[model samples]
Target: MAGHTHRQLAVLRAAAAGHVEMTCSREPHLYVDGLACCDPTLGHQLAGLLAPEPAAPRGPGLRVPAVLTAAGQAALAPSAAA
Candidate 1:
């Protein structure tokens, strides 16, 4: 399983339910419906992390699945209750 930051964990929890995005609230926060997407910077970071690494060559990117794969579910499990 991937080691996720607290922010990443929060994002995964929210996103697990559906697509995640920033809100148009006065604070300009991130959210998905009733849930708030915590840590705007990390939210964007996690979004980048979730994207499949660019086509393989000699590069320094962690290979992540295009979608929330089984590994991702495992990563989120430990933090879901919080």
Candidate 2:
């Protein structure tokens, strides 16, 4: 919430808005095509944001789920001071 990049904040906001499904993997990559936007992370960061952890599905494709939590929603909120 304090040090995440603009991209990182956008990723979480997208998830909260149900704009796209996130698939965090070992491979460092991000996706954006039309209305489809994929935010790929190192898995650990997303794990900290969501709960229960993502499943370790077989194969090379990303198969984990990344849903925004309460704190995540707050992160997207505008600061009251601002």
Candidate 3:
């Protein structure tokens, strides 16, 4: 696995703990603890780390909690801790 930036790793950690929230869109937005993440790149990076959640069919503005994939959890492992 490629090394992740500090910010990317932070997002992964938050996602693993279910502390991240995300919007389903072309350019998804991510929030950590109800505060928006200003870094747009984090959202793109998380695309690979997080597994897609089964979203309910609802209105346009739906924000779902984020979940990490196995790879993401691996990235946060002690050896891979960045």
Q: How close is every model to the real structure, measured as TM-score? A: 0.38, 0.49, 0.79
Name the candidate that leads on lDDT: 3
Steric collisions counted per model: 0, 0, 0
Report how far residue 75 has shifted in candidate 1, in Å: 0.5
Model 1 global lDDT (CA atoms, 0 to 1): 0.48
Give candidate 3 regions above 4 Å deviation: 55-60
Cα lDDT tens digits, model 1, 1-82, are 2556666765666566655544322233455554554455653455433433234232333222233446566666755444
* Deviation of model 1 at 81, angstroms: 11
Error of 1 at 23 (Å): 14
Best by TM-score: 3
Tens digit of lDDT per residue, candidate 3, span 1-82? 3568888887888888778888877667899999999897678867767754656443345677778877787888887743
Candidates ranked, most accurate by TM-score first = 3, 2, 1
Superposed by TM-score, candidate 3 places the C-alpha of residue 67 at a distance from the truth, in angstroms, of 0.3
CA lDDT, every model vs. true structure: 0.48, 0.50, 0.76
Worst 10 residues of 2 by lDDT: 28-37
Candidate order by lDDT, highest to lowest? 3, 2, 1
